[model samples]
Target: MSRASARNVLLVEDDTAIATVIIAALEDEGFKIEHCTSVAARDGWLRGHAFDVMLTDVMLEDGDGLASLDSVRKAAPDMPVIVLSAQNTLDTAVRASDSDAFEYFPKPFDLDELVQAVQQACGGSGSSANLPDEPDDDGMPLVGRSQAMQSVYRMITRVLRNDLTVLVTGESGTGKELVAEAIHQLGSRRSGPFVAVNTAAIPADLIESELFGHEKGAFTGAVAQAIGKFEQANGGTLFLDEIGDMPAEAQTRLLRALQSGRIRRVGGRQEIAVDVRIVAATNRDLVPMISAGTFREDLYYRLNVVPIELPPLRDRREDIDVLCQHFLSQAVEEGLPRRQLSADALEKLRGRNWRGNVRELRNVVYRLALMARDDVIDPGSLADIIGDEQLPIGQSGDVRTSGIGQALETWLAAENPSAGSVYSQAIAAFEKPLIEHALGRTSGNQLRAAKLLGINRNTLRKRIGELGIEPDRFARPL
Candidate 1:
């Protein structure tokens, strides 16, 4: 290929020898390569030049490869990033893909296969600005295939035909943003920009500026005119994630904008009319918020015109195997040797209560892909990566002193329970030992214990109280 036509490749590898070899190979294949050893350097290079593809190592000296992948996707949505890792664990591969990696390859990969991946990525075989950085090999929908998810898909199809206000409610990590993307992709507004803003992530003081454009000198840091998400998403979908976290003042302003279909710049009186569809998502119960007077009832009703609730992963265990296989295929496409979960591993995955939902499962799978020694992952390997304390009851019974059967018996022995009491008891029994083990691992520091348990400190404390457990006994001596 001519120099003008050559694909630009950003090679991010710490190992100089490996980088040299890959650069030479890629050059031989008529591609231009720019090599960097860290995310910081890569970021600097990207600001000055654009690349068709990026090849990154997971454990960079300065930062993580996944973070770099996210940055690249955000800056250049169409560019493809392929992750390289020496660890080669299932989690690494799955995470790389889930983070929008175009592909993942273990260290010491075949040169020909790597070149092929680069070629396909650069050739735009599966390229789109809105397409996931990492494509799902199984072509499954972003969420589960449960009746709930099927209903979500059908609603999304219908909503895409018009610009309707969408309210998606679910627990965190239930893929609410994914649902928003689906609607945008299938809707008449496909050609318009899809802007997403998390109300919780932004500081309460600056939220109004984030949603409505600000004129230069509007605030201390307003050095230049800034267009907000609303203006950017005009004629498209503006996904307001964590809408429940929005402040009262911002909520009132947002409601007015929704009703009038217009927004005024923070420092200017000019009213800019926008034709945008608002899609808001939240994990909180808005009905309760409305009743409690924290959230406006009128705003809640406006946003909830088309309500969609995403079922948590626990409710759709039937789709576990399918999700696992889908992630595996994606891992293989990333360049790892193809892998599969053993029957025991699959059972372990299916039985777990994924509190973090699909996001957590994807992380577990990525870790397993990197750590498993064989093509078929086993329960032991899965437990090791997810940690013994976090493994499901059926998978790591040994980690808990109280056996699953014993815990179940004890829970069933409790009296005067409500309907689904058995299910509640079973869950507590399964979680109690794990929490105890995690506390043991962390020497009963509730904060660390919560991290080990993959939950918030407050939630962990609540569970400890509910289970009638004490931490002093398991705590290590200071």
Candidate 2:
């Protein structure tokens, strides 16, 4: 705490209200504060004095704060800079990261965290040496300013400078692939080729050949020599989609490749060294798969060096309106009839539980753009399009008519799962979601969730780990 007594902070923020809050917080922490309202005043202060760290906003009265950090850095090359901006987007985050700022905080950030970040910057707990700030024309792909997305943006920026393998997990249609794309496009590997392969889409028999660049004449169908994903992504990135679906044999090989940074083609004895950064994504619950012995625990740890858990769309319903508009614009650009969504229509859209996440919303918007009768769509038309998404339950909402019954019937018809194992399989399937529902309502608190589920806390905790359920995702951010 005494470290900040002699440390100095030069804050460049134009908003009086925001400046007051930051100044008050830093002063309470025993730091010497020099506040400026514009980039001009900021540079002047930098020229006249020396400060341990600088905090600047993106937009200033006279010029761009981030764009102008170069001059400030030239004046004080060693001074770490933290950027604050209301423009919350992946683009802004990448720019802030590319500028080599100590930290980038989207607006509505926690004041306490801000103070702590300044403390760390001044204390040199993290390296914050200044570097040139550059701008990219087309890095603003992902949308939504909700806190959920903000958390994602921050995590993305943190890994831009390194080649740590990232495991992106979320439900289907939650834009898991988009996270992979963002990291590949904005990170240090931006210039390298990005190769993506869906393990689930490829045949299990050929999964290894597809990934390791199957040796020619290695297998019956392998008549010609073929290069694998590793060779294709040499010196760049390989995005392994649906990694949980990879066969067990392939999992072992993948683990070896990740560990050794070398791959051996199928039927070939020679080991070829390749430099490739891995970014794997999956919508399936990998922990459960690992527990079920379908997925490799060692391989999971290797790919999960940096875990980025993407929030489902339902969790960020506040962004529904913006997402609708974004999709509508895309629809327009694609030559669909331009349509406007009314407040009531958006209200109706937001009301539904978006079980399909962002992908579902985009599809519905695109459909509305093409099919709506009027230019401005209302709630009536919206409901008609969305139409009774719920199951055909009885008046009392009987369990038979609900989705679980239908799924049970389908499973009985399909897998048959063996008469001896049917009960266990059904329990395995239904019990996971039942526990998930409890943890969800209790915000991932094991003790509280256990009480609600009428089970012992330790039992519920044990079941959670055994089922590979991640309780932290259900826990709301503080």
Candidate 3:
């Protein structure tokens, strides 16, 4: 690029280390660099000079970077702004796009990519209509800075402007309802009431009346007219939780209402029009249910118009530290004394696999805040609390006995054995199921079962002999 036509780049960043690296790269590209450390300084510079492209950070010494970008948007609508943020949440990315910034870059960002964005931004273009950022006071309730959560945030933002039905799928305790509430709170119908009905919680006989309302004296117990969830959620969003558990009869009624955009009371004839956005969530796999003819395929199609899959906490270990801090802050606000987690304790938390996802983590944090004596939670304190908590397993087994420790404890509590033999008995009790499960999973192929068990085939064979496990029962017959 020639000096005469070289672009002017304004960088608003506070960290000197990051600024130095950015300035060196941009200056070497022949662009004139003007640095501003705070939003106040940036405003003054904006008043004095015209820049070809602007790069700003989310956090500055004086004010929030994303919030301040609105000024640049108004002052020089045509000058493209590239937002760099260390706050790599979905909210940050959405706010950047809403501000009409040319592009958004998460920190530890690739410099080569930033350069490309600046180069593209330098190409002159007129201002576009502005999208107002979400209110500062209304922070993102769902917390996670991982890339997985970022994808979820982007999806939430996309569907916020529309009334499209959304289906949120994740394991239990992954905050499915929270996602539903976020969409309702942030979407165009923020003022409307959000009514959530759990399909599984309601009895099968009452689901119809629970959702579609009923006329007075409609049934044996119907003394008065009842307004159902669909009508209650009028002009807003209706969240149907555990939708897979909705009985077949209720599923039919729901599908009909979704298709026609109208509903009739359980025992009344007049069709009532309901302008409700449906957001359904389920932990069960609807596809398999559809195949089994239990869950309605049509209803699945209707609610799945916009699908949001929330990742479980175990998959996003990067977020564990932040989540723990958030829960700890919450506990403090709710009357617990302020407490902090030691670095070692946080690392230990990050290393463990959370079966209950965010909910489980929150519970542990709350427990620690209330029970732990130390102001700073250390590994020892964390271990004592965590060790007492039972590790949950998959749906295939009973949770109480599924965990090795829990199973051993249950056995010892029941049997009065010689203290010496109790240890061996417990070991055998734990190993039996584990080896059986491995054999079952591998169809009794010793080599495959050994691999699954992470042990040598010979060791596995020896263990089978010692434990008296009948591997032949599980073996695939010739």
Candidate 4:
């Protein structure tokens, strides 16, 4: 039969509701499915049946569904299998990846995406994942079960079996390094070294040498032949933290290395071939930098092959309690006194801006574990620890601004729109709004608006024209 008629699917799911939903959706898509709730029945059905694809769950009534996949693979080795699981952890995602599942869908997934995936999977076995030995350690490097994190987990699983350049972008302290560790430690290169270099921390002068080692006599401080991060991370991942801060010259060498899969030591004759996966991360917005010519656009494309953007803790406040608990356990392991988290304290935590994100939360949790007077931590204890620092930006609290000085400070730090046009850019950004406000208050009367704004009427008119502001819209009859 042609690929279009390849709609025979076997679903091994235990949940009645989930099975009903999947069966209905698949049947509606014109797929003929054989549904079973247990691995025993699945195996019995597989004994005489042929299927184009299989969809199974991790946990079943009798035995582990993933373990039973060996028989299915042997029976129909070419058949693609998709695994669904409510055990929504990175480990399960990795395990499903290890079992050669075409796709791993976490519980409460979108039905439309599932149907789309089923339609695509029926066509061919085009998955790039290879069966590698599953990681032995069950440690959870990352936390949170929110839908945002599930998207992260799925993306991580997709890259475990291959060497794909990954770019992780997020605000500071959003666990970019943890994502890097998860990718390396759970992947086929787990045995290889995981080398991380913060490009932002390194001086512009030394970044090139830091990344691609220099010869013993290459520079003034070249007392010995140094191994660069590229050599150190051979056969594993090279995590370039704050890639946006890489100097122009270093960006050139880095792009060449990525292009050639090799690098030449500074002042060295021979180039060395290195087997390494590139995982770059940046807290800064690189697109703006690229436009400003501060960051290389070509390098951005090279590193952004598989982009995974992490949400800030403020966006995922529902995860605050679990993250706090996780950090509390970690604090105790580090010899801090153990403490129970009170519901009121957790509720209090849900309010703050969490400007520092997970790293900030972890710090607060550790401090609470250390400074709490009582065994059960409460809001009183939290207040004592974070006293006078809470900005009242949390749930049901007022979001107070830090004034224009603070706004300018934040803008300068984030944008650095200087580039010899700082004044012009600043004026271009703020002048339009200020003029619009004055016009609004004066009903677009140019003379009164100019007088209110303390500027000449002609100047106001010229600016209004330059800013493309139509004061007539805000005007009223004299």
- Best candidate per TM-score, number? 2
Off by over 4 Å in 3: 1-56, 60-64, 75-82, 97-105, 108-139, 388-478
Clashes (N, CA, C under 3 Å) per candidate = 16, 1, 0, 2
Error of 4 at 385 (Å): 2.0
lDDT of each: 0.76, 0.82, 0.81, 0.83
Backbone clashes in candidate 2 total: 1
* Candidate 1 residue-wise lDDT, 1-478, digit = tens: 3223587999988999999989988898889999989999988888889889988898888988776565776677778887777754333444553565666676667788788888889877433233334333343347444545545654664464467899999886688998888777655676789999988778888999999979999999999999999999998889999898899999999999999999998998899999998999988888888989999999999999899898888887877887888777777777756778999989988887676678767766765675466888787766654544444443445534323443444446668657888797566435765787687678889999898777899999988866645575567764
Candidate 2 lDDT score relative to the true structure: 0.82
TM-scores for all candidates?
0.56, 0.80, 0.68, 0.79
List of clashing residue pairs for candidate 2: 213-228
| Residue 397, candidate 1: C-alpha displacement in angstroms | 12
Looking at model 3, the pairs that clash are none
> What stretches of model 2 exceed 4 Å from their correct place?
1-3, 125-135, 388-478
- Residue 234 in model 2: lDDT: 96
lDDT tens digits, residue span 295-392, model 4: 99999999999999999998889889889989988888899899988998899899876756898788678767865668998877666555424431
Candidate 4: C-alpha lDDT: 0.83
TM-score of candidate 4 to 2 decimals: 0.79
Instruction: Write down the lDDT that model 1 would get.
Output: 0.76
